[model samples]
Target: MTSNFRHVALIGKYQASSAGSTGDSSRQALEDIAHFLERQGCEVALEAETASNAGLTHDYPSLNVDEIGARCDLGLVVGGDGTMLGIGRRLARFGTPLIGINQGRLGFITDIPFDTYQATLSPMLKGAYEEDLRPLMHATVVRDERIVFEALAMNDVVVNRGATSGMVELRVEVGGRLVANQRADGLIIASPTGSTAYSLSAGGPMLHPSIPGWVLVPIAPHTLSNRPIVLSDATEVAVEVVSGRDVSANFDMQSLASLLHGDRILVKRSEHCVRFLHPQGWNYFATLRKKLRWNEGGS
Candidate 1:
């Protein structure tokens, strides 16, 4: 551990390859950005699968996400918010700081826009910015006392009805106590880092970035009683689907889609944290104001 790093990993969206012409455009951005970093005197390592998507024969270094995070001072993620989730989860493993350049709209996670690539990245290479510590959530989607799909998220973990109109029922528990028998399209448990994301879309409250609490929001609940609830770090929360003929849960809304029945989901504050490299004088609330469109005395 060098207290900071020099080698960096660059991650992008492989799923977005089907985004019509936008896919080709996204792929090109990755190519241009990697070359940009190399020119900046940074050793850039890209995800192996990304090479395949680019139709390039070059091999990515044999490195897992954790290894990349451990070895690299930073992880630069290109593409949409989904790309941020993919790399953010892995970066949590070794507590690596990430710099996201948004190539997508709103770009809650991908805060820095592509147009500011040079301006935003130049200071980072020269070690000239502050690290905003962002919390991460660890989720385990399990069944029969066995781990099925385990992951960490800077945003949220979703347990939803995949490709089905019927709701997915779940009994919510906090610290081993029953909270609610949820009847909804799905459930979202998000960190403050994720509060602006799916949780916000699902009628969850907005949490300040440094709030140090977790938000549990039900997606499309059948009853109005179920509102998004925030919990402290010490609490242990579990969600178990009551019963279903065809049940599925999506972690992070998209990826880790369609899990099976009898699954018990566990969510907790991860021991690890994610540090983001922000432009100097970064203001979390000010950024939120711009993204959320909080007008003066208006909607």
Candidate 2:
């Protein structure tokens, strides 16, 4: 209940105007938040890119991610989950707490809506909020036993067919043990926070944030015998291309890299975690019920 925050950083989409929400109109909503923070005697700095996108005047200070992470107590994201994902990956390494204001559709992680952001903003400024520490995944692609592409994902890492319409063959292993030889469109390795994302659309189960596990989902598996499985987050997963065809590896549905024959992808829980600050009264189940429209029917 101690509001020790002093410096705050504001980050938004490069083109906030692309969003239909008023929040993005000349970055008006972000300006409003900055004013509110200033009123609290907090030093506000905008992310350099976001400031440039908004055409911010020289009156306000703009800093890069590294500077903001080094100086700021909280980083505020004023766009959708996609924006949060990108910023989260960078800021998480600095251990800076992040708060999101949803300005896009289906903002599962960006919980605060533009309309009610002010109401929620007050408590957060006073250090009255909940914190959720989420895990990240480290992925590396190996060719001929040499490491090639590598990146981190806050959501899921997928090994998918590149251009061909046909399913691909993959050999999946857990902790150096053979798990399955899967023939499918692709394979998804998702963290608990990602269970509600691509994995969910692939018929994977929803995992609570408290679950210390990761999910393996086969996308459009050729056989009905293939089912989604949840394993300990500590488990390391290795996916090898059994077929001679090339495939694509995607991280968080953003970063992409091509994988050739004999290529292997190694995925494991990352030592770093992203910390999200939620307004008081925020409920994970409630958010899920609303987002998934689970309120429609129940047992």
Candidate 3:
């Protein structure tokens, strides 16, 4: 959905994702992004809760996710990559596009750095930035075939051991047929856009953002025969915790309370898609090169 620019919403880590010095640094980045977006001709909007913790003292404060999504054209999400995933899920329905500014380590999704905002995002606000459309996955964690928690993940939906070190035994099925049962750390159901995130960490191969493919990658599978499998966007995948050696999930780390043992995760291509604004002439591999230091030196 292309449109002329009007309202822009900003979301960030007001509290902390980790601990200690990392938390302090995240708070600072949140503040900087707010000021930067304001200077970029976009009024800042945030949850009342987020604003207070970030020491945000703006007279013209903003609204929360629901209100901002309804009114904003773009959401400028700041923080680590996790922050962008939260914003994307919270405001997924508004058809609102997002631009992420990376503030922490290993920001695979939030590819843009704070320093490059003006060079890449300015033209975007003026309706000049290019757009990349990626498919999102809708997941339902069920028990007894009854829906428990329904959520959206731009990356992968993982079912793995929680605190235990043992392999999480899972039974995978596609279109109601059994795929395999093996022991592993976890299983990753990832979108192409998410291939570089935890899925990659779990040994999944990197995929082009343009390709509409989903990957089933097992984390350190006990059997060598259990390899990463690619499926079309049309295939629906069902996974049940046949035998949970204490397993849990993290939906982009938004809410950990919902993930528990005996939970079943049903993943399929979602009707919703997230639009990303890239600078003119932005290339996927080129961005990866600079961000991942593909050919760069050991600094």
Candidate 4:
């Protein structure tokens, strides 16, 4: 079949060790997928870090993330959600669409199963696919009116007290209006795409990806009445560390430690969004049911 994506970038989990069992399997999968893409009339390139960590020595060109973003029409991420999250954030700026092949547990965003990837991916290459646009959150840590750290999160932005520290006091604001002053273990500012991640575990609602909203969930709040609240994505949310010991902020996998009093975490919707391509007829609810085992005991 003729491919809609002529130049495709293949990214594997770089953290996998070449000598480990998982790495060996991932390497084999990458090779097989590369060959399959070739047969589909698509030119494939290996992501530089994937090539190095997987010990790949294929004739295909190995390119960095910037190169892939500029040149490739599609990015096929072969790993778990974490791998996809890392690449998604990087590729969002370039507007390059992505497809995820599940190589790790709890695929979530990486919904394609390895065993059936060839069957699923072939049609997608031929323009038979579903497009999903997931929004990203831009988080910044501001201290004393200066920007200290900044990152993009596809999941959630978290603020937490140190492991040994007591509860943190955070003053929350939305659109420059005071929302609350809560004493809690921490706070989570999660985008719709992040609703099912850490936020879900912290008692936040599971928001559909199509929702244009954010969920604020407090972790172990001292007040029982403190509950998760959803707000429109158009507004900016600020969380200031009013009082805490060894506080920190985390944006998805990226973290900034040693937060002091008055350090404010600013979160807003990013202008760029990640685009995911799935097989035609893919349904978000179906994915949730399958992954969450919602029908495990159904007849």
TM-scores for every candidate against the unseen true structure: 0.84, 0.94, 0.85, 0.97
Give the winner by TM-score. 4
Q: Which candidate model has the greater lDDT, 2 or 3?
A: 2
Compared with the true structure, all predictions reach lDDT values of 0.75, 0.88, 0.74, 0.91
lDDT of 2 at 16: 58
The per-residue C-alpha lDDT of model 3 at residue 175 equals 77
What residue runs in model 3 are displaced by over 4 Å at the alpha carbon? 1-4, 16-41, 104-106, 257-263, 296-299
Model 4 per-residue lDDT tens digits across residues 109-220: 9999898999998889989998999999998889999998899999999999999989999999999999999999999998887898899999999999999999999999
Ten-residue segment with the worst summed lDDT in candidate 3?
252-261
Candidates 2 and 4 compared: the better one by TM-score is 4
Tens-digit lDDT string for candidate 2 (90-177): 8888999999998655478999888888788888889789999998999999998889999999999999996755889999999999
Q: Report the lDDT tens digits of candidate 3 across residue range 1-299.
A: 32246666667765554256755665576666666667766766765545655555373476778887777778877777766777777676778888877765536567677777667676777788788887788888887768878888888788777665677788898878899876888888888877888888777888898788888899889898899988876888987776655577666556542445566788898888877776777677776777677985432
lDDT of 1 by residue, 85-116 (tens): 77777677687888888886657667888888
Judging by lDDT against the true structure, name the best candidate.
4
The worst-scoring run of ten residues by lDDT in candidate 4 lies at 290-299
Q: List the residue pairs that clash in candidate 1.
A: 5-73
Give the per-residue Cα lDDT of candidate 3 at 144: 70
Q: Model 2: how large is the Cα RMSD against the reference?
A: 2.5
